[model samples]
Structures are given as structure tokens and as C-alpha cells.
Target: MTTQLITPTQSAYAYPLLIKHLLNTPLIYSPDQEIVYRDCFRYDYKTLGKRIKQLASMLKAQGVKPGDTIAVMDWDSHRYLECFFAVPMMGAVLHTVNIRLTSEQLIYTINHAEDDIILVNEEFLPLLESVKDRFETVKKVIVLSDKGAIPASSIEFSGEYEALVSDAVPEYTFPDFDENTMATTFYTTGTTGLPKGVFFSHRQIVLHTYGVMAGLTAYKSQANISSADVYMPMTPMFHVHAWGMPYLMTLLGAKQVYPGRYEPETLLKLIVGEQVTYSHCVPTIMNMLITSPSIKDVDLKGWKVIIGGSALSKGLCKEALGHGINLFTGYGMSETCPILTLSNLKPHMLEWGEDEQVEIRCKTGLPIPEVQLEVVDVEGNPVAHDGQTPGEVVTRTPWLTQGYVKSGEQSEELWKDGWLHTGDIGVIDQEGYLRITDRLKDVIKTGGEWISSLELEDIISQHEAVNEVAVVGITDEKWGERPMAMVVLKEEFQGKISEKDIQEFCMTFVEKGQIPKYGVPGKIVLDAVIPKTSVGKISKKDIRGTYGENLN
Candidate 1:
């Protein structure tokens, strides 16, 4: 078929879709929409544009060049937003360092990414100083202080962040580059080993942004985001670009509020003060907000939040809805540009009752546009979309990561048969919605039955006394593995609720056919809190390691 080839005329020109181009429409249209950083400062999109250019100028002045990696460790702030644009726009890769990682893993990610320089928030200076000697590529340290003057540090400062931007020329041009140029890189919070690096190109990010916008708006969604939407990111910016909401908001020129740090009181204040209309986070944050005394008297009506990074429990969903907050589920991971599915209701489905709506909204969701998703058996055959046939969810999308950086074996495993294996076991409904049952490793195979730990967690979290829950499979001789639950009780319910009560609760679900009898955990260990991964998902692997041994 290629034997006859023809070239296009010179009249045709190709325009690459780089990250810098995302700022063009906003600068032209909504130049005055404010980007607020808590109560500390506020700037319009015009100034955001200017600051981004200045930031680029400053980085260039500091020896950053195309393809160099500039890392940032800070809270979700205006400065982070500027770097989100400026660093990538200048053709230098942005490495959003995860402060939640341990000192060792933190050093590993920075070294693996080959970051040439790091911009550290004052609070993290001690972390930098502890590992600066072990850094493989770091050459400069720039301090970022939101408060008063930064204290003296053992590690010498290359330049203060604010000063660098202030001193630089604001007129530096961002040259266009190939759309496939690597734009940003970050490490995934893996369970079994050190973090894995995943990166995206300029074209992938832009497409993901538009795809998310389309997915949110293409249906009847209370959480639909647009220019009128006031945006706040509850997810950490260091994690999957805060599910990439920052770029979508900027592209739409929406009013943005960056809560410097996530405190319950501070978040409530900003939600009320800024009228934050839309946000996204894991279920833990939702639990915190709903239970916090600060939000008790606050009217959270009209606040739409998309829950991801973990499953949304029905109890949590009902609680958020009771407060008149529009809550739903979104499904993605650090690998798929962090978003491939969102559980927005169809137009006809909107008339369904609230219970049905919550049920639908909590599923893994339908795939967004340009995303090809499938539930496949071990042999790579497609499963029947009957809502009961469980299989691994594999997908093909333009925005998915090329592969794990420098890990060829894992990368090959990720893209076997030309589809990106998600390592997620799920079932697709006849209506085309995906319900993720469990991670491939987290599923309990007991007495020749597969039990979903997420299912158990969801069922137990409905108890009035339960605050949070995690279910993990513990090793056993008779059964290959048995489920054990670690629970966190509400303060008032502590020491009052017994393990038997939870067991009896599970019995009720078994009776109702919600879960099988074997799916119930043999024990429920009550605690003050459940440990979480760096990105806020419940750390089931840690729980298994702690309790799964010597359970005789």
C-alpha cells in the first residue's frame, strides 16, 4: 500500500501542541480571573502568564536548558502552578518531588529522574540537607518560603524562588518544540518495591486535559467544570498533577484557589471564602472533611468533589450527599496520565433515585474519550459485560505513559499484547460501566473463592462507629489466604464496638447477598487510624506485612 507515496504541498503547516500553548486562550480571554494562594496572595491570569514567563527566564538564567529536569518540593501553591507551566513550557522536564516519600525513596526518585536542580520549600530544607550529599545530579538548591525569612540552612541556597522570578525579565519567549518531548516526570507510589518513574509528553498532557474536560461535561454531571467553576485541588500537586485538574483549570481560565497546606480548618475557610465549586481527592480527605468540626456549621451545598485514588464507600458517598455536596467517583492511576475514567451519570440516568445515583457514581466508571478499555481474562480474552465476570482491566490510550523509565522488564510487562495492563481486576456492566473489584495482588483467594478486599472495606465502613477501614488477605494453611480487616473507629465509638459486632455486621451483608460468607474477615483490629500510602490510598501491603504473618 505504501508503494505509491505522495507528499503534501508547502502550503500545509504543522503546529505542535506544547504545554506553553495551553496558556494562550486564557491570556487572551480571562486574563483577569484570579489565582488565589490561600489568604497570602492573589494574582490574575495575566500576572500568572507574566510570572510563568519570568519563572522560565529565571530557570534559564540558572543554567536550565531543554530536556533538563527541574524538581520542585512544595505544597499546592501559586508558585507550584507557575512551575507547572513555566518549567515544562521552557522544554525542561518538571519533576514534582513527592515529599510524602521516605528520605531514601525521595533520594532515589530525584537521582533516577536525574534532576539537575531542585526548588525546595523552606519546610523541606532539612530533608534536602540530609540527603544532598547522596544526590546523583543535583547542583543547586533554591528556597521557597511562604512565611518570613527562611532560616539558615547547612545546604547553600542557589537563589530564593521569589527573588529569582522578581529579578528575571518577564519577556522571554517559550519556543515551540515537538509535541512528543517529555514534559513532566514523577514517581508512582508502588506497593511491592521502590517507586517507578512515569512520564508524559506535551501532547499527552494537553489531550488528557481536553479529554477530562470532555468527559466531565459530555454527560449530566453535577461536577462538570468550566470557566465559571471555581477550582481547588485537594489532591497533592506532587501526585499525578493533582489528577491533572490544575492544567484543565488553567486551560479554561477558571478561578483557582490553591490551599497552601491541607488543614481541615484552612480547607473549610477557603471553601467558604473562595466559593470553591469543584475539587478532587481520595476517600480519606472526604472522610476528614465530612467529620471535621469545622465543616459542621458550614454550608457545603453546591460543592462538587470527585473522589479518586481510592474507592468511594457508599457510607462516605451518602454522608457527602447528605450535606448537599455533589460527590462522585473517578478512576485512574499514576500510569494513565492519571485519568481514564469518570463516573458521571448519563442524562436519562439522572432521573434515578439518589441511592441508585450513589451506586452508579461509586463504580470505576465508563472510559473517557480516546480511551480504549477492556476487562480481559488471563488468556487476554474479553470478558462478558455481565457485571459479574471479573477480569483484569487493560486499556489503550494516547495519554498513557510510554513505560516505566529505565525498567525495561516491567515496561514490557506493562504493555504486553500492545495493551497497557492496569493490574486492576474489574467487571464491566452491560451498561458499559466498570466496577473495579480489587488489585490483582489484593484479592483474597480462599477455599477456591476470590474475595474482594475493597468490597469488604466498603461494606464495613457503613457501620455508624467505623471511621475508616482496610481489608487485607492474610496467609492461611487450609485456605490459601483469609481476609483480615484493620479498622479505625470514631473517637466516641472506641473501645465500645467489639470485633464480634463487625463480624455480625458482615453476617448481615452475607444474608443480603452483598458479599459471600467467606469474604468476611476473621478479625478486625481497631486503631486510631489506618496507615496510607504517599498518595493517600490505604496501604494494604503494609497492613498485610504487619498482621498477615503468624496469624495461626
Candidate 2:
């Protein structure tokens, strides 16, 4: 029999799940590991820890206090990583401002967050100054520059980032507080009216870090990351903490390289120079890199990449595989603290042929531990996991965002029925792999049947002359909605391929029973490039607004 044991007095060392604790594991094991910043500078993990303290000291010297919010705008760099920890650890909220947003939307989010301090990159000085007069709560602006020069700007300079931190002490006592304290905030990039603010607490972030680490290390595949691997993020740091990889990697004591800008040449060079082994990006960014003239000579054989933000098409996967890139799909959204599933194969399935594995790799993938994922009907009933039946995907996980910042109505809709509604339609197979069919709002309906726009696009992507394609439901007086194709042909086949060619090619899939006959598009509009969202997702919402008539 076991009994409770307690000291007569407090233990004096009770631990709170603070963000600073994440640095403990790395500080102990790999204090000397390197974190590179492009090709510009490099520092050891020991220095990184010291810099984090310096950053906190600097913030505190600037009067940043508990419950205040601080905003940052910069490319993916070591400085952002420091703020990810320093601001939150000090009890101030870190608002990762999405610099890619429209100027008006950016202003709205800034006001909505009520940030007291803004740590902005030199490049965004003009952008920040343009709306500085309209900000209601901004108290100071700290400018960051890689070359150590603060540019002249209209926004009164509070100080330069490097200069202020240089004079601050390298030590500060981070106080203890409730684990549920708000740690960070960022806005979702939906094409809806305004960006909705989502916030996470210290406890939630710590648990999420553990969950992501478990998902990556527990899997036995090419994407199974370890401390030995060099990490780089192709996604923007302002976007969900670059899909939360920076924290996950640093905790594992992995070497990280931060590319200042996303120019294809720079990325390819850093990949080769730093010997980066693991990376994640949206399909559009990967597409841009793969098609770049510079990537042809690099050795991508052991490069493990997780493609997210949108569905990965057959054409893109084939190209990546041809270059020996270990490519697969991952699924998550801003509301989920970014990662929910990764497409890693089962142990027994490892021997399967490459083509067979690629099929599974391209699916939406299986959920990580602590993520209870379910596909459900409109009434909230669970759907069968029979692979053919489609339903909306919902999930329950501890790390998920509690709700939108202060919008009770939207927050209620987000947590309806005690499950986080993902608004994504998916199908789960017998082996427990989930494949997203389409967004609930993007599915096409015609002739009394539902057709998956993703399925049609994937099929069309395999066509010889196709480069990219988007399928949408266009208005039809008789059918209610009809599938229309916005096709982007390969450069070699620009005008050589016609609308009939695409429609006819789609029917071949129908003849093979791969897709329904009605799934074929009625009209195909050739385009040079398909419009995309800021995160590289197909701009279906914007496309519908422009081309879709009464196609509700």
C-alpha cells in the first residue's frame, strides 16, 4: 500500500511550467551547439541563453511589465527566437505581428492587441511609422538591423535593438507566476473580415512543446528529428512561430539556421552551407524553390521536409521525390498551436515501394499523441472511419487555443459541443490515416452529389501538361453549383493545352473510376499563376469573390 508523503513545510522548489524551463535541457547537454543566422553570424547555445537574459533585461529596462504586450516584426532570425522566450518569461505577452497582412489589417491587429512595445525590423520601419499615429497603446519602438545601423524614420526612436541590449546586464530574475498567464498572441490569416486574435498561456505552450517533440521523435521515419540534425524553417517566423519548429528544435539542442529573407538563392546556399537536414514549408514556397535555377545542383537526398498550409498535389510530390527529398504532408492550423498530425509511415510499411509510400505521405496524415481527432457529420455525430465516408474534422487537445481573444460569439463557435471545430472536411481510412478532402466551405456540389475540390485538383495535377490547378464550385441555375477549374499550365505547354484538353483528361480519371463523372469541371480558365493566401494556401476565398457569381 502507498500513502501520501509531504514535508511539514513547503518544498521551496515547486516548479511552474514556465517558458524558461525549456532552455534547461539544452543548456545541460549541448550548451556549445550553434544557432546560425543566415551566413551573417553564429553563436553557441550558451551565448543564446545569455542573449535571452540580456533581451529580458533590455525589455525590463524599457518598462515592460507583467500583463503588457510586446509586438515583433522581422524575418526568421535568432532575435525572434529570443523574444519568443524573453517576453513571455517576463510575464509580458509576445504578439508576433503578421507583417504580411495588409496595412489596414496590420493596424487593426496592433490596436486590438494593445501592444505597449514594438520591436520592429529596420525594413518595416516605414510600415510601422505609417500607422504609429493611429496606434492607441504603443509606447515605444525598438528597431533591429542586421548591419547595426538604425535607419532614420518618422516613428520616434525609443532606441536601437542591438545597442540597448548591449548595455543591459546579462542577468535578470524571471519571477514565478500562474502557469495560465497569457504568454503569446497572434492573428489568424483567414480571408474573412478581420484577423481574429488567438492567444496561448505559458502552460499551454510548454505542453505543446512536449507534444510536438513526442510526435517527431516517436515516429520512425525520415522526418524523425534528432539533436544531430540541422534545422531551418522555410515558413515565416511571424506565422505560428514558423509552425512552432523553432522552439521544438532549440529544446532538442539542434543546430538552427535562420534565413533573413526567403530569396531562393539564399535558401539554397544556406541549405548547402549549413547542411540543413530537416525543414518545413508550405507547398508554394517549396514549389518556388524547386523550380528555381539554383536548386538544381544541391544535394537534397537526405533532406526531410514536411509540407503544410495546403494540400500537397501529386505533381509537386513527384518532383520533390525525384530530387531525393523525403517529402510528406503535415496538418494543423493557427488555432491548434500549429501542429496536429505528421505523415510518418508505420514500421511494417517501411519496406513498401516508394510509389506506395508516397501515396500515404501525401495524405493529411495521422494525429499526434494527445490529439483526439474525429471526423463528424453536420449534427456533431462521429462518422465511420471507413475511408470513403467524408465528414468535418474536429479535435480535442490540451494545447489548443481556448478561444478567440475576446470575441465571445466566434469563440463559442470554435468550441461548439466541447470539441474544437476545425472547419476542415476529411476522410479517415482503415489504417487510421486521415486525408483532408476539402474545406467545408470549398466542397463542390453538382447534380445532387458532393465532389471534393481537392480530389479533382490532385487528379488534374497529375496531368502531363499541368503545373497547378484549383477547383471551385461556380454558380449554376440548374445544378446549384458546378465545378470550375482555374488551371496553370507548365511553361512548355502554356497555350498548347486547351480547356477541352483539361476537361477530357479529367474524364479519363472518371473512366478509371478514380473520381466521379460529375467531378469533372465544366470550364477551365488557363492562368499563369494561381492566386494564394499569405501563407501560400490557394486563395480560394479571394478567387470565389472574384469569379464565383451566385455559387454560394
Candidate 3:
């Protein structure tokens, strides 16, 4: 006898109902509080959302269709936040261009995405102007600035951002868009090669938002969060949607504080005065904040932080715990709707001691609900749950990007058998916790075994003298490839340490065989500070590009 498969009644049409029902709910809430933008102006969210809707109305009037892509270039600000919602909710795709990218790469992404209009901040206008002629698809330019006049050189836009919104009706209706309609497009950071685009639909973003709120994921509760909680995202808006916190904050109805350009002092002051209860940034940014001279005088007792965009160092995690701040680590990528796993404590782990709990919280974490994650070998076989054997991490989620935009190479490898290969080497514990051991490309192969550069970096960063560190493989004739440590020492101990000290420390972790003789970095390059990506992880790509070729 053949068995019949049954589908749940709610599974067939749950998305549209949720979207339409939640439309008029209090999606955004900001208290009557002051948010100092660059130590200057202050604005509330009621005003912010009004401006957002006005901008949405303006975009609608300008012939922006549902599928059109509107690219934005600006620092973190109320206006930037406005574009985050207005463009997407209006059914136009918001393409946040990475301002730190090279001019050529910037031109390449813009032309490739075919952005219909470019909304640029005044400070970035000159950079845009340098490649203005190269953007063949952009028909209009909307300047976002306090300056009164549009520059004479460029063609007149419909109007300046503020004026255009002021003239438009704020009450314009947001169209009923299908959940599957394109909502936003962001290009990958592309550590190795050209940037590729990833687009998210309304359904994906909405589901991602819900997944973020679930207690098993980030465990963000509106009850725990209030209108009083001030949010300052240290991550830039241009990178991986700032890990999607801006939208999440809006959805949670929290008061958001925007730091236009990240200055450690500015951020610290906002946290103290604004009583910032929650924030999100990468490990490097957290390092900068805690180590900065300004932090000594600041009171950060109630601050809760979420660390992502890269691995969180044990050193940084310890420092955060010391400050009486609640810190949690998560993992994701630009292709995975930016959040796949978050380190929330499991039910059984709650009985463990505080120290034991922190260790688990430091891992990459369990896959968020609706996301399925696996550690697979070279042939895609699932690795054991013993947590000792390492394998390539792969996943499937509703929010993950279908594939890179306009790129054909390795597309098959990226989404083979309907799962996204993360290229991260990791293992899953019996408790289902995932700990990323290394990036597949960055893993050191010596004596026919894999060495995790991430593991070594985490250990080296624990030294009091080390400020930041990155480990990359240097080609070796004998071992094929060996690990090299590029370090940035704490300011006070710059010349006081040697490469031998770092090597000696690694020897204590394991025997010579367990930690390969060649696994220790052959050379250590000392720098004033390690270069970092926009989201604040140490940029090993930059280090390898600068120094790897020199190694034999």
C-alpha cells in the first residue's frame, strides 16, 4: 500500500496573511529622546518614520517601480535609516553600496546592478563624481545633505532628499506587494575577487525578521527591549545590511541612535548618556571600544551587545563580560540573509556554571529555527556530532540568497543539491552547537593535516600584549603551506615582544605533533594596527595580499 503525504493547513498560505495583518501594527517606535548625530542634531523616530514615508512618496512619484534598484551611499544617520525602510517598503530594492570599495569595483557593482537612481551623501559625492560618468544605468542623482544647493556640475535631480520628501505627502499608501517581490540588493564583500550581488525578497526579509526575534535565535524580546533602549550599530549600513539590525530595531519599536561615522569616543558618550541598553558590532569594533582611553570613565553596566560579521575572540568576550555588559556571538554571511546562527543558551546549558555557559556562548552557535545547518566532508557526507572532526559547513534557509548576481563561475558549487556551501570549516557538538574552526581557504595544510588559523588567532589574541591578530597560510616548499601570524601589539607594548614569544605560547597548547612543528608562523609582521573590513573583523585578505606573495 502507498502512503499519502499530508501538508499542514497553515503551510500553504502563511506569508501573505502575516504581512498584511502586521502592516498597520506599531512596527517602529522611538521615545521622545535625544540622539546626538555626530554630536550635532537630535531627532525622534516619529519624525524619522514620517520623513521615511515622505521619501517613499517621493520615490513613488519619481517612477520608481517595485522591482527598480535604488542605490544609497551614506554614513549611519537618520536619513540612511529612512532609506533602509522607505525604499524597501515602497517595493523598490535598496542597494546599499560599500563606500570603502575601490572606485573601479564601485563602478562595476553599480553598472552590474543597473541601479535606477543613486542617493548619495554630500561627503561621498566627490567619490561618486569620480565615477559618475561610468554609471550608464543611473538616470538620476538624489543628493542627501544639509547643503542648500545641488552642485552645478551634475544634472538637476527631481530635488534634494529633504525637499523632495517635504513636498510629498507623507500619507501615501504603501502598495500591497507580494512577499516574494524583491526588497533589497546588497553585493558581497568579496574578500578574494569581484563583488557579487545578493537580492532578498519581502518574504525572506520578513521571515528573517521573525527568526531574529524568536527566543531560540537572538532571543530579542520587546519586553526586555523598550522605547528607552538606545541602539548604536557599530557596523556600517553598507555591509551585509548592517547585519540587519536597523530593520530589526524598527520592527521591535526600539529607539535607535545612529553614529554617522564611527568615532569610539562618540559611541561611548552616546552609550552612557543615552542609556544604550543594546547594540551590535563585530569583534574588532568591540575591541576598539573597550580598549579606547575613553571607556575607562564611561559606565556601561546595562549595555547588551551582539557580536557578528566575523568570529568573536575569547579575549574580547571576556573583556565584555568584565564590563557588566551582556555579550552574545552569532554567525552568518552576506548570502545567508546575514544571520544563520546565534549563540543563545540551550535549555540544558542553563544548569551549567557561568564560566561554562560563556564558553558555549562563544561558539558559532546552533542554527536558528527555519535554518538547517550541517558539517559535511569533502563528499558532502555529514560529520559526526562528536565535535572533534572538522568538516565544511553547509546550510539551507529561506533567507539565503539564491546565488551571486550575474556571476556564472562556481554557481553550481555554491548551491549544489539545493544547499548553500558556507566555505567555513567547523564541527557540531553533541548539544548541536556549531564552532567554526577555520575558513576553508585560510586553513593551513601541514604534514597532511588541517590547522585552524582561527583557532590560533583566538589563542594569540588572549595575550595581554597583543591588540589584534590574523593568521594566514604562507606557501612552504616542505609542507605545502604553513601558518603566518601578522600581529598588531597593544600601544604600550609595541617593541617589548618578539615573534618567538608568540610561537612559544602556542607550544603550551599541545605537543609538537598535535600542534605541528611547521604550524607556527615562520614570520610575524608587526603593524601599528591590523587593517579591518567595514564591519570590523581583522582583514586577513589585506594581510595575505600584502605579505603572502613575498613568502616562498
The lDDT values for all models are 0.90, 0.89, 0.77
The candidate that achieves the highest TM-score relative to the unseen native structure? 1
Q: Using Cα atoms with residue i matched to residue i, what is each candidate's TM-score against the true structure?
A: 0.98, 0.97, 0.91
lDDT of 1 by residue, 459-544 (tens): 99889888889998998887878899998888899899999999999999999988889888887788735788887888887887
TM-score for candidate 1, please give it. 0.98
How many angstroms is residue 56 displaced in model 2 relative to the true structure, after the best TM-score fit? 0.6
List candidate 1 segments past 4 Å from native: 1-6
* Candidate 3 ranges beyond 4 A from true positions: 1-23, 27-45, 147-157, 216-228, 347-355, 511-514, 549-552
* Model 1 residue 307 CA deviation in Å: 0.5
Record all residue pairs in model 3 with backbone atoms less than 3 Å apart, i.e. clashing.
none
lDDT of 3 by residue, 1-552 (tens): 999987768756443612322324343333443444655557765666567778888988888987789999988877777787788777788899998877888898899999999998878876888898787899888888766456654645657887787898877667665778777887777676777888887788778877766733245421134444667888888887788777666665666788888889989988887777888888878888888999899888878788887788777777778887778788998888888987877666667775786787689987878889999998999989898988999998888887778776667768987779999999999888899999887888876878889888888777878888888887777777778888888889988888888788777765745566666777777754577775567788887777665356
* C-alpha RMSD of each candidate structure in angstroms: 1.4, 2.2, 3.4
By summed lDDT, the worst window of 10 consecutive residues in model 1 runs over 217-226
lDDT of 2 at 423: 95
Query: Where does candidate 2 clash, by residue pair?
Result: none
